[model samples]
Target chain A: MPAGTLYRGREGMWSWVAHRVTGVLIFFFLFVHVLDTALVRVSPEAYDEVVATYKTPIVALLEYGLVAAILFHALNGLRVIAVDFWSKGPRYQKQMLWTVVGIWVVLMAGSLYPVLGHAARELFGS
Target chain B: MSSDTTSATIGPVEGAQYDADNPAPYIEAPRKRTGKTPRATRGNFEMAAWLFMRLSGVVLVVLVLGHLLIQLFLDGGVSKIGFAFVAGRWASPFWQVWDLLMLWLAMLHGANGLRTVINDYAERANTRLWLKGLLYTATVFTILLGTLVIFTFDPNIR
Candidate 1:
């Protein structure tokens, strides 16, 4: 009934929201991905052409974002399972969420090295 | 040690109003968790779906990462991915099986996740049924098409 209750969300609530958002995003990506890959069945040239369009700067950046989303979704997904199944997971739930976030940050940083390096060369290289 | 202020205003904000249209006090509906379902009220499907997400996600970390590394990072990265590369990779049963497993697991996991979403948000029973029906159809079609593509892929079918 109160506006504070409407706006104020704890970590679990936000985490659940992010999980749903990322999961839906990945599902949409896979839809396009599958359809494009299926182009290979039609002809390799078609497949190569479709894949080549993804080499541009914007798509490259989105790919990296996709990677980050997948990483978070996967890690938090594991936490969801633990919370649902493990005996002590609820007690340490906040710790589990933080642990997943920490891993996600480290992994995203590591991934940026390869993803951004390639993107930079593609965008700037003569 | 006790510092109290009479000027502090701690109270609920005014958001609700009585409406003449409905002849009743209007209040925002409490968030309804539409969690009841055949699966929830009957079988072990939700639990299985829960377990599958974790197991498939763990395996997908390996399968998807390996696939991405080979396709997007190794051998000059995305530019190197093409007809010949895919043809060559799928030539081996190893890559074929790897892709097969990835396709199946990711699709099923994602579809199940969406099924949960539909169950939660579709609200009306008819809408939820239709949405889930559409989801399952697409899932089956993609999985079958993908499995066929993996196993029956002809490198020389030019």
Candidate 2:
């Protein structure tokens, strides 16, 4: 399928697309993460100043999105592997996808306190 | 000599019995075409990659989520995650290994996944090769630099 058709694809296909997109995003995050952490080696003052910036409302919101992406990608990635290697995995692929989705929903729900709570406080001071 | 020189032709896959509904007799199949399916270099590379993605993904879930929970949304949230915080965490070998494993697995998995994407979409062989070369170089540089910083980090350095 063409790149455009990827979004228009079925659930399994969309899962694949999500996996790839999330993987790429996380990769970029890691790239910056290393660079920023390396700043500690230069000077703790430099490191603290940069990391402190992430405490704002906007960055908190972005962090929430990052968590969502990583959660979905990680859960669906396991499903992908199951379908690839397990003997009956193909037969149960849809079920597995749903299961992953269910687990992801639960995990994200649990994380809401941390992700959105702080963001809301930072944004509205509540 | 001319009779002995046959063109490269593919025959139907073995055991494909004739069907009366599709009664057309088979001729020699078309020769290898540029757009034809590539040879199956069926190396363990792909199998290992597939396995590595899943395995690394599982580990990454734990390492990354824990790291985020600690560094971003815990104790005092991102405000608490600074040089001193990092130094404190890295003081423990557990945190150091966690960060190191997270770094290596995520980089390799992301690079490999992108490699598949490039192979799938980059039409020209040269484009594919060049793109992958660029990706590999970046991946290697980031991984090596990140690993060195993680291990050689001096916490007491003012």
Candidate 3:
């Protein structure tokens, strides 16, 4: 909304934006996660009760989304490092991003069964 | 090539011969700091933060991915996770240290990242101050709480 704030939109700028978005999402999730785990200090039932909510179909979808966010953040983070440390990183950042995306797609596809398979089974009665 | 105009115009200096082989000395931009500038104004905190992001990020890629693999992917997936699963993992000193390192590094890394975001987006000075205040408070609280949980966890606290 302000001048000098937006850069020329491209792979570089969009990746930066995605990185910020995912980082914020993951940070907020970490806050909740820490609080949830602290429930263990309260009682095993309390912790297990909360964790049960995580096994639901709706929450399974959210978990998948979380995985997507974390995976993107992690992979693109490596790309950011390359752009900083490697001599020719800047020159090949676009290529590296595509590579990151490629790997992300594979991992996400591989993760679907592990992450959401139980939810699918519960919903469909397998 | 306009010979008359070129001949009348003087180069950067009267008798200086600037060519590809020997270029003119570089000029410092306006407001650029010099040797005489105060050191306090040029503190290395931002640089350190920048470096910390990269270093912690590389390590987090390993730590977080491995964590996800163990918790979400292996052996019955999320269905297998519960108080008992966590108890089993945290029982080992190896996992305790792994989790401790992860909690610290990820918390600090995320906090510094959000600090940058706040500085960038919060327009007014007071707005930035208050946002960062809340951010720091939450960050410290979460870090302390998580660390306490990890260290003081009782496997048999039924």
Find the candidate with the highest TM-score and give its number. Answer: 3
For A1-126, candidate 1 gives per-residue lDDT tens digits of 855534336667788999999999999898888888888889988998998877777888888888888888888878887887899887777789999999999988887756666678877894
Which whole-number lDDT from 0 to 100 does residue A94 have in model 1? 78
What tens digits encode model 1's per-residue C-alpha lDDT throughout B108-139? 98998899899877889999989999999999
Going through the candidates in order, their DockQ values are 0.50, 0.57, 0.76
TM-score of each: 0.79, 0.79, 0.88
DockQ for candidate 1, please give it: 0.50
Global lDDT of model 1: 0.81
In CAPRI terms, model 3 is classed as medium
Which digits, one per residue and each the tens of the lDDT, describe model 3 over residues A13-121? 8999999999999999999999999999999999999999999999999999999999999999999999989999988999999999999999999999999999999
Error in Å for residue A12 of model 1? 1.2
Candidate 1: residue B42 lDDT (0-100): 55
Instruction: Mark the regions of model 2 whose C-alpha exceeds 4 Å error after superposition.
Output: A1-8, B1-42
lDDT of 2 by residue, B61-138 (tens): 788878777876777666567777788888999888888888998899889888998998899999998999999999
